[model samples]
Target: MDYPPDRDSWFAPLSLDLILKVLNVTFFHPFIAWIIPLSFRAQTMHWDAPPMLVSIAWAACLTLAWIAGVVNHRLAYGLPRHVDLSDEVIVITGGASGLGLLIAEVYGMRGASVAVLDVRDMENGEARGVTFYKCDVGDKDQVARVAAQIERDLGPPTILINNAAIVNGKPLLDLDLAAIDRAISTNLLGAFYTLKAFLPSITSAPDGGTIVTMSSVLGHLGAAHLTDYCAAKAALTALHKSLEAELRISHPRVRAVLVEPGQLSTPLFHGVRSPNAFLAPVVEPVDVCRAVVAAIDAGRGAHVATPFYARCAPWYNVLPAGLQVVARRLAGVDFAMRSFRGRLPVGENGERTE
Candidate 1:
């Protein structure tokens, strides 16, 4: 299937992310920061010299900040259980296409027992270690049946990735009841059904298991013409948080990973445009997949955000209402979907594509 072309200009790729990545390695990195002080000392600059003193102070601050980050991570997430990919049985929803499919294919190629539960057939046909189960996640009965089959075929699931979602880029008033139902059912409610079906096996597993929830930045920032989609995604974020809280209290061994990405260059948002390519550039599926895979491999509960802005998306909600309005206007979140045609063209049938 043909997807949207990049249609980006030469400088579109230069984003704050690029600048940060460069700085992280060169200056911001604690190791690199210390190197400057060492180099200054090697040059025999006096310890009290202005440049030497400044370099030493900078290195000290960077080192302290780096140590604090390590401490924060340890306190926040605790220890990570060792993960052996060969022993994992992973199940991905909406694995027929898009980000879900990318992850399934990668894990399949790596020899993990992967089960893809989707209403449609696998988009790229079957892969090495991946099994396709034709089931709609929005339907609890189907999810249960498929869960049983997966247990019988691949052993009890050790990982669950809740990646199924649909988008209807229409204003609240413009959307019909059916559209709203479809959005909430497949996006928010599907996660609940999947968790209910799989969490038991996960919590009971020898090494426990990981639960990954795929949400969006739009969930935190409501956008015009995407009321239903935004609301459903917002609920997903809440569900992930609440589930994480409950699991930490009751099922401490089971890990919960929340993934919130900005616009992806996928069929799910086919015609949707990024208002500012340099600021909120369309995210690539591989980057998101890599982050998810790393989090799962590390066997730790993680909050993964793609690109750069998504990591700071929650701060938008903290701004005053008037400032929030101004921020939305500057970001063009409201009008980003003005030309959204989604996966389906003007008149084509809309099959699930997440």
Candidate 2:
């Protein structure tokens, strides 16, 4: 069941991101930049030559930039906590399929205690070292019950990845009240329910813990058709900020990671079109999962954004309202959801369809 190497070829294909990645590893690399000046000097070129001076300066700049990146991460996240896979227990909500399932499988195969809470049955009918719990994260009572069961069976969870999400990709005028409520409950309230149920256990664990929130770029730049979806994501982002601030003062040992990815190549956004594939390619779930896993494993807080464009989405908020509107129209953000068939039906399993 090996999937083709889509991610590797995806980044390799012609795109602005690929160009930057190549430059970063070659011309922009400090070691590679330094080699240029050294080679010129070896060829009997004078150090005072314009090319020599430029090369030396470029190399120094690259070195400084690399060091600054390290310093910034240190100041932002502090030191990383020790993480031993054998002693860690991970709880992932909505791990039946897509990104959540990918991460759950990886951790399970690595021998870490893994629990997946989902209303849907395991997509692959359960994997070795992974326990499946039939619980809807959108339901507080269900989440609480599952939390207790997980603790009793697999020990207190040290890593909580809040990845459950739903989208109602319809215009505000076209959406029904039920759709709006469902989007908010599943996308926003679900995270709160999980935190309420698991935070105590995480705090009580001797080794500390990690909480990962799955957010989206739409939260920063709301779209027309995805009103409810965007609103819920926006709330989630704000909640993550408030939670992190509180944790910083009360429990600094506990880490929080926020993942803000662009449109994903999953059924959640199936039939939707990307306005600019070269600049904003739809991200694969595995790419997002890899970043989440890395941040959790390092035991440091992180702001993970994928496809490069997502990292710049926040800057759109600083633009003038008129300009922002124009950008949205140009990017086809509002029209992107003209066609969206969700994973489940409207009333099935006490969940909403979008």
Candidate 3:
């Protein structure tokens, strides 16, 4: 099958997600389920008739399932804390552009204190409430110094978005040690550094804080040319789980959010293409930002995965090794990066930030 390059295709808007969205509001919704049975009754159909009985059963099942989902989340993640946007001081790494920038801008417009930490300046210049902090999260010293400055400048951060990431887009053997180190430090260790530097302030704050990790589904499904990227992301997910477990016993108030999204329409993965656009469509930066904002504003812990298939990616690990190989081939997992032409590295200045 020929996957068209990023163009205004006639079928561009058609995707598995679009189909599901339509179904959720109609067939899968509890309200719609009840409406079906009510419509049959309005037609003067017998109560025991097949359509009425089936619709009634469907409505009951959907309602019960909805209730069970709410119960499950409450038991697993605990109750949501209060979120007052006015009191929030958010710190987003890699917020100069892409998904991180979108998030920072949204919170900034809402009148919250927003600090954007990046090696480069803001790609679109400055937003209303967002203050750009020129710092490389990959450097522990830079992270520490910036943390102190942020405290003095805009109060201590009550939320940390660990969104800083870099991809060399190379195989393990082909990548030089220096490139590997940069990727590991920025993608994996950067999160640890930020948490260590900021968690103290977060714990001390009366409102507590939320830590957001922008992970990837490729973490679970290690790609052909993304060895370093996969390893770092895999570790990130593990870190999120371990930290959440520790917080439950110790802090209990701080929330941890792990976001595992598929390919996104960002310059970072510029030339890469999804194997199947319908089943595994490229996510929009805005979509990921919206989900993260909802989690933070709700003051709750969440494991968010986008484009539908990302949520199912974890189950891939349970398959037989042979089947895994076959699935990878069918999904074109390893081959997806064959045509990779990633974004060029940006410097400390605004130049070459793209």
Candidate 4:
């Protein structure tokens, strides 16, 4: 299988995420923050001294903020469910390659029964515990048939990852009706189809199950030459929220995880460069895989946003229209897709190379 070529330079690794990662462990960490004041005291610094006072205050603020963050998480997400890999039957769409493949391989290696549903064959041919099913999610009949087959072959699926997607790098005016239909069908309606086909089995399980939606930051911030893609993703975000709300009431054991990542170094968006590499660096599939795996393993519903800019994507909508346009110009959000050369020429059926 051919992978996307790496075009990043030595400095590409020096992104804001890298800087913040270091700061998080060293400065922002509550334990490390307190260490500063303790170190000052070890040097015989008076408690009321300017330096000591400042260090103590900084530590106090960090500690309080950390506690608040924990409280907020608990209040927002509630408690996590129990997860046992041996008993899990996992299903991942678009597991033929890229992010979905990475996740399938992870669980496959960990002794879980993983079923991969995709229109194409698995990129690596095979995996240890993964069974590949040739199914296009955009086709409701295919999804329905595959769901039944999976239940028979691998038992009821306890985890479902809706990660299948395709990019049609064309402006709205340039896109034909077929292209628009394919994009929306595959990117948005596909999730609905899969959920409808599999949710019954998932909900009927004694331990319940998890549903993961793979959205994008572009969903929140519409970009040029990606009208169909953006619109589909935006709808996906809404679908995820509504599904979560319904599951919370109907089946409290069912978990819903939402992942909205920035541009990833995958063939899905090959040749699309970030306008500001430091501030909006391309995300890695592995980074996203880690977050998804962590949430599933912990049996918790999470709002996973990769790359710092992705987490801030929601605020873009709240800004004034004039400021929004200025910010878009500065970030080159609309221009980013101008050079987009996706994995391959997508068909009207939304065929994806990765």
Candidate 5:
């Protein structure tokens, strides 16, 4: 299905994130930094000259920072395992649409054995190589049966992507028991069920495997209307951390990647407004899919956050309660979901039916 246009106005087109992306490949780059110093020296400038000295310092700082990033990754994620697309079987939950569908389609087209498990049918029908299985990941019995089927149909899965998620944009007081249960079960327990069913196959793979957990920034900053969703996502982040620590000692070859993206422009979050357009422009599924694909292809663990705000969201948690409350008010976190219309089934007239 075709995605809606960005529709952002001219000024909305510019963001701090866009500027940072440009700088990363230019002025802030080590190569670019060194080039400035070399160009200054080519003019026969003295070593002690202000421009030359400043350029050298800048280059040194950039290089050191780059080195530190490498060191940080080594310490945090350890080493990468080997992955061959031809031999790796991938299983993605909620592979019917949005981000999960994108990842499944890419892997399928690239010749990896792919299995898509979702209660809904493939949104755009079957892709070239993706095999669809109708399974609600929240149900352990169904997940177990599908796992066995996948194993028999296409060897053992070497990569698992836990991307299924559902959101009910109602206040805690307004949500019914069934709605709360559905949100928690699908968003949190589904991950646990999938992991329990697939970890054995992932660990048993000869070349090891990777696990991708789809989380959200809401997990870090709870909002008014999303109490249950926030709680579930927060638990997922903790689960990822604990699992990573445990696997580091027992199955070092298995990698874990955590994706925490802000408001995405998908059917899942149809009418929700962004708190700030320039600061938190809704992320596209393709942008996020690229990061996930890269992490899986490299066989390394990573924490993927889009837009500048998401990368800095951790700092907000350290702020005082009063300040956090003020920030939430200013950012409209509580009010953003006021008009939310999720991806419930719709008829041809573009009106929701369920």
Candidate 6:
């Protein structure tokens, strides 16, 4: 489905994220920081001058911070595993559309064996090196059957992306049991089923594997009119953390990446409004995919958070209760879904209409 661009003012492009991106490369970078002092010296500035001293101190601080970050990552995730796409078989749930589809197509083009398991057909028909298997991740039996077929057809899986999800933008009182069940099963239990079915192969693979879980920032902060969706996403974050802990101890080579992104500009979130465009601009799916692909290609475990606000999710939980309420109100957390018109309406059999 094609989604039209959101209407915005000329300044819509000027976001906190854009400002930070510029600062990261020009001001915060170690190389750039050191260049300032070197340029000052080239201009015949005395070594003890205030400007020279400040520049040198700034460069040293930035360089040390960069080294500390590298050391922290090494201590936390250990060494990176090797990834050779040609020899890996990847399975992506909900690869028929959205972010999942983007990742599948990328790996397919790169000569990896990609199997997409979705209840719906592929949105763009056939893709090179990608085979579609119609299977609802919510159903354990269907997933089991598809797992066998994928193993037989494409060889053992070395990468699994648990990206299947469904959102019901309704208040708790308004949601039916069936809708609630579908949301939890698809968004939460679906990850468990996929991991159980494919983890063995991934763990046993000679090159190990990477497990990428697609979660959301909403998982950290609950929103109104999205009770079930929020609950399921929250559980996914917990699930990823626990699974990552176990994998690190028993299977150090297996990398587990947790992706918690802000609102995305996808058909899944069609008419949903952004509460604060400047502070919380809707992220493009391509940007999230770029981070994911980079992590997988580098064969490392990562926490991929998109948009600057997403990285601040953990901090939100530490705010006082009263302040949390104020933050919610300021962010319009509950009100943003009032105009939500998801991808399409659900059909009689629970499948979404194209």
Give the C-alpha lDDT of model 1.
Answer: 0.86
- Give candidate 6's root-mean-square deviation (CA, Å): 1.8
Candidate 1 residues 89-127, lDDT tens each?
A: 999999988999999999999989999987767778878
Error of 5 at 93 (Å): 0.4
Cα lDDT tens digits for candidate 5, 1-354:
333534453125777788889999999999999999899888999999998999999999999999999999999998888889999999999998999999999999999999999878888988989999988887789899999999999999999999988888888889999888878988999999999999998998888999999999989988888999999999999999999899999999999999999988777877777878777788888989999999999989999999778888989989999999999898888898987777675333424466
Model 6 stretches with alpha carbons more than 4 Å out: 2-11, 346-354
- Output the worst ten-in-a-row residue range by lDDT, candidate 2: 1-10
lDDT (C-alpha) at residue 133 in model 1? 94
Q: Rate the local accuracy (lDDT) of all candidates.
A: 0.86, 0.84, 0.88, 0.89, 0.89, 0.90
Candidate with more favorable, higher lDDT: 1 or 6: 6
- CA lDDT of 242 in candidate 3? 95
TM-score of model number 6: 0.96
Between candidates 1 and 4, name the one with more favorable lDDT: 4
Candidate 5 clashing pairs, residues 3+ apart or interchain? none
Best by TM-score: 6
lDDT for 233 (candidate 5): 92
Tell me the lDDT of candidate 4: 0.89
How do the residues 273-337 of candidate 3 rate in per-residue lDDT, one tens digit apiece? 78888988889888888899999999999988998889999999999999999998899888888
Model 2 score (lDDT): 0.84
Error of 2 at 156 (Å): 0.5
Residue ranges of candidate 3 with Cα displaced over 4 Å? 1-11, 348-354
For model 5 the local lDDT of residue 75 reads 96
For 183-281, candidate 6 gives per-residue lDDT tens digits of 899899999999999999999999899999999999999898889988998999999999999998899899988999999877777788788989998
- For residue 334, give model 2's deviation from the true position in Å: 1.2
Candidate 6, overall lDDT?
0.90
